[model samples]
Target: MSVEQVSIEDLGRELGERIAETPEYERFEEARAAVQRDEEVQSRIDEFEQLRAEFMQARQSGQATNEGLQRVQEAQDELHAMPVMSEYLDAQDELEDTLEAVNEAISEPLAVDFGGEAGGCCQD
Candidate 1:
């Protein structure tokens, strides 16, 4: 028996295309677009980011940022409360689970593990 020669890049590209065809991926894209169009959601996200930065800077400078931390938590909650953001988060989880399953399937035969490795867009 002869093993077939195949390009890893081609296989990866085909896998990506197949994943993109899934309904979960489509929903993820739609949810992301909805979030993008929501000004309130975007502002809440920006607020959390700015507060987080302030908290980090305070930590770096050995200063207190309890207020910033509290504000960041509030902003995070507000962002999470948005319907569009909630939908986006749900879709994101679904897509991530699907990709993890695919990665496991592909890595199993190759005797490798793709879980917990950094550098992917879904990095935790």
Candidate 2:
């Protein structure tokens, strides 16, 4: 190939390095690290997951109850209320928005959605 015909792999690596240097990326990294280091946040997340699993099992066994549902909801609420989890979630949203904007810019010249995984129709 000619010198003018650069590989997409090289371009992708260059782009990734530049993106990592941005303040947005730094904030995301710091928030992610903080969340990981917070034992309280991790514990709450584990508890919430456990409660959710129990709820699912109960539902599958036709043994679901309002109390079980309430327990799961309460655990979820407690987890979301944690400062570390909230900050991490906000940072994650910011990062996703940044990525989507980048994708739009990348796809604009081609007039195509240069693309990410398309989600299923069913809502969680």
Candidate 3:
């Protein structure tokens, strides 16, 4: 079929489906699942999130201290030091790299960057 025969949304959906079948995506999914199943990692993530939230709240209320921010950072560092979390982060990076390559391929043929310009303004 001609390119004009298919809607851009349909093409985008097909691309998404194909991406989901890729090895990088599969690895990322598996790693993420493993992270979810690890109780220790989950507990650490929860603690870190709680610490971050409290720090944010304190900052908003003008009561945040340097020590509070340092604690949040330390908690984050400790969380990332876990083997499961490391694997998940690596998988995530690989998947992001794959997506970036795909974005470049899609953007190369167009006058404007497909991923950047296709949003039609109001992008954050």
Best by lDDT: 3
The residue-by-residue lDDT of candidate 1 on 2-109, one tens digit each, is 999789899888888999999999999999999999998888888789888888888899884677678778888888888999999999999999988988897788
* Candidate 1 residue-wise lDDT at 70: 82
Top-scoring candidate (TM-score): 3
lDDT of 3 at 47: 100
Where does candidate 1 stray beyond 4 Å? 1-6, 115-124
The sequence of per-residue lDDT tens digits that candidate 2 reaches over residues 1-124 is 5668769999999988988987778888999899889999988889999999999999999999999999999998888888888888888888888888988898888766666533455633
Better of 2 and 3 by TM-score: 3
Backbone clashes for every candidate come to: 0, 0, 0
Question: What do the candidate models score in CA lDDT, each in turn?
Answer: 0.86, 0.86, 0.94
lDDT minimum window of 10 residues, candidate 2: 115-124
Residue 54 lDDT (model 2)? 93
Off by over 4 Å in 2: 1-4, 117-124
Give a tens-digit lDDT track for model 3, residues 1-124. Answer: 5665888999999999999999999999999999999999999999999999999999999999999999999999999999999999999999999998899998888845765668677765
